[model samples]
Target: MASEWVVAKKCLYLHLPLALTSGGSFLYMEQYIVSARKYRPSTFASVVGQQALTGTLKNAIATDRLAHAYLFCGSRGVGKTSCARIFAKTINCTARTPQGEACNQCDSCRQFNENRSMNIIELDAASNNGVDDIRQLVDQVMVPPSVGRYRVFIIDEVHMLSQSAFNAFLKTLEEPPSYVVFILATTEKHKIIPTILSRCQIYDFNRISIADMVKHMQAVAANEGIETEPAALNVIARKADGAMRDALSIFDQVAASSRGKITYQATIENLNVLDQSYYNRLVDAFVAQDVATSLLIYKEIREKGFDSQFFINGLGLYLRDLMVAANPATLTLLEATDDVRQQMAERAAKLHPTFLYKAMSLCNDADFNFRQASNKQFLIELTLIKLCQLLSPSPDESGSDEGQMRPLESFTTSSPAPHPIDIPAPQPAPAAAPTKAPTPAAPAAVHAPVQPVAPPPAATAYSLGGLSLRSRGASAAKAPTEPSPAAPAPVELHRSKPYSDADVERAWGTVRRSFPAEPMLTGIIEAAVPARKDGDSFELAVGTPMQADIVGKQLATINRTLRNLLENDSVELTVAVCEGEIPPAFWTDAQVLDHIVANHPAVGQLINKYKLRLD
Candidate 1:
């Protein structure tokens, strides 16, 4: 049945023209033009995008300030070679032309256009990257141009040249003959050595803009008599990513597939590209924290033969675009259509900055580890799950009353209210001290009635100076019942001498010595300074909030030890986050080692021998 259909289709096509002619009718048949050939830029003005680079070159030519060695650096298909060829022709053309354009009518220009110009030399360094090739090129450079005044050598993919080959060509590149001009083009500038880079006048070409590419595509479509949707052309332009050659290739594929009538759907289908709607759905799923839906979408794409890596990469790029749209300063960098941009901006506004940062980080990490992962699909799924988690508030940030509620042990029952009490009463003296010192009870008896009993003050309610129990509410609280004579009154432990600076310093020394040898713990202690002494309490100033938190956890134990040594039950500790100089002695072992390695060459050598990493 298939063979029969093929024969019937062929017969109909073969006889249709004959049948039409026999009826005495003349129907004009449009000429067929491939998109790549039809859309090729014919003039400097016709080149899509790259206006700045092209304009600069033209102006330079007009001013007669041509460099002997030129290096064109950019990605593929941005017209590096085409520009070089045009520049070469414009320079050698004998005929006078406006705007420094090549006169195609001139003998030199005609020869170049016909590919028969002896003065112009073109080499693909990719296939000819060897010492012998460079030697041969040097030999050719020794000869003068047969027709044009200057001989031009255009080498594409010059970075492909081997190290030896690059070295061989260096002398000639740096000091070419008066009549010889060299133009080297490369997509990978980093691969080229500094010596080679220094020898050439570098011209970095930018990726063509989507607007310029679309406009150029429209012109090509008009000239070819092909009806096309603006939206379709825009999609083609984006898929090209600022490369005119890629855009033309996509254009050709779409034009053929759509039979000269291109629409957005047809272009996307022919390109085997995921539609914008897919990206939209993926983003929606991500925002909604629908991990299943995200995974399903990924699976569908994978089932459709799209590469996992490509899909992941595209998703990352899409996320990057959305991130850019979220910020006004970076919105201009988004290359999507106006409708897509608006959608992105709306979605970006809904996303929290922290969530966006986390999602981007996850995607980047997944991308980096994708190739090395054993289960690539699972890796992507995991990344999507992580991204979904970003949409939901973290457990620590959910504001759940239960999560914030402390255990019974952590709660203080001294307060009348349901909230935990924050009373900072002095620790009772040990049993042995009570038997030894009966005089200690005298101060307590004297001050106990005078010092009114009051509710523990909230840290927020009280100022740093001190909380005044007497002034806040002396009349509201009921008096405490007198204790039995057997239960001795609490001793009002006091220092005969107020805490001196030396005492505080000694306390700091004891606290510092008590810290565990762990690097992280030591680091916190080192950054903290003894700010001041208030009665029995010592105030510690930490360098950062993080350091303050670290020391705050250990404050109770530290205070107990300090108070025990001082024989003062009223001893207390306070930590305040402050900005101050980090002491030199605070350096962790790793920091000290790094400092030594960075400053002393001998230490660096020793470090390298041990293959050590700083903690």
Candidate 2:
């Protein structure tokens, strides 16, 4: 039945044209052209977003200083081939315009436009990139153009040519006939051999700016009788990512979906783009430190089927734009329309510059970790929470110890109200008698109430490991009233006494014993006993630079502890790396066994009975 239907359709199509001819009417079907090719730049003046390059080429042609070989380099869809073609047609035109453009009325221009000109040739090197193809191209170079002054050969994707092909064509490319002009266009110029690059005049094409693309698309939409919102056009241009070809293609898709009326809502829905309004609202939630609202917004985004990574990257870009808009000098950096940029600036005004910077950094971290994250949604939610915390007042202006997280309740709109408590002013304790090492006592806490005192400052809240909440209220409440200035407490003077080497060694042992949790540091300190050099100065040598650095970092703490232990206030200690082999700090298994046998003979017997070896 399918075959019969096909046969009938073929007969209908064959008869329809003949019937129309018999009726003295010919059916001319209109071919639908996509916006990309339909609006492709023809003349140099018509080229979009490439004024400087087009002008240079026009000047070269007008001044009759055209090079025998030219190289055009840029990313895809940036008018490399288009400019090459325009340059070729203009140079070969019998009658040129005063602006250095080809007069389309001339025979050369008309033939090139209609794709029948023998003077111009286009070779797609991506497919024919072998030695034989280069040989064929080289053979064709020998014959000049029959109709025009110069024969132009435009090679597209010139980087795809094989090494052998490049070597084979190098000679001809370097010294082509005077009438032959070679134009090489590539998206990746690094792949092309240096010989080919050196033989040509290189022109680096700029990426079509978003503003340029949007403006050009507007003109195309008008000509196509399609109504479009400026916001919709901006979205399309950004989606293209600096590619005019891509922008026009996206425009065609959106126009079809919207049925000739492209609105912002319809455009985003068609493209499956996350709305910028989500980011705008998210900024508000961050400023308010509203974690719940931010999380809810993330949930809504997930429900709309947007990937978490894409959402995070988009958020980072939005924050970056906000940061850029926060400064007037950088407002031009935003690639958005005036109205959209103005709205962003207004919203950015509400956020602090520091907050925007930190928020952007958080978003960047979330984006970088998105691919490796097992729970992508959770990562995004946590990032959003961190952004909210950026504006929260920190404890003593130092953020949480856990680095980017704090308890949600700790962040408040304002400080909590202080409460009054009646307590007696505590008496000062007597100073301790100087011993070998005197430990400072903590301030005494007042228990019973005697006289009224001023209320303490509001307790600052903090989070421990981002898990539990803690506050300084206990210490703040126990703090005694300030003493009267008439009878001030006496100050204690530090002791600077003379000590022997034995005293220094004993003090070093105490310091080493204190680092029980850090065995490496303990071992490093024990490698050498500090010796007095001059006055109260001393030095200790370690095995390596790393050990020296470790000891250097703790030198101040060690000096303070040692000075207190020795009752000397002028103690100074320095660490030095030794020149030779480092002494072993850890005991080997054999040494341990021998030491155990020497200390307790029964341990060796037990090891022998168990047939155990420490290796």
lDDT of 1 by residue, 1-615 (tens): 565455555656776432222222322244444466555655577666788888988888888898999999999989898888888888898874787788888898889878898888899999999999989999999998888788999999999999899889999998999999999999999988999888889999988878778878888888777899877988898989888888988888888778879898898888877777777788777766577998999888989898887887788777788789988888879885666577789877655454556667788898899889999999999888776655332321211112111110111011111221234244553433211111112221221222211222222232323422112211121112122233323244454445554555555555554433222333445434444454665565433343344455456545544554555557666665433333446644533443343345465443323222232
Q: How well does candidate 2 score on lDDT at residue 7? A: 53
Q: How close is every model to the real structure, measured as TM-score? A: 0.56, 0.63
Over 4 Å off in model 2, which ranges? 1-28, 395-615
- Compute the lDDT of residue 485 as modeled in candidate 1: 38
Pairs clashing within candidate 2: none
* Top of the candidates by TM-score: 2
User: Which ten residues in a row are the worst by lDDT in model 2?
Assistant: 445-454
Task: Judge candidate 1 at residue 92 and give its lDDT.
Answer: 90
RMSD of each: 18.6, 19.9
Task: Note the residue pairs that clash in candidate 1.
Answer: none
- How well does model 1 score by local distance difference test? 0.64
Output candidate 2 Cα RMSD. 19.9
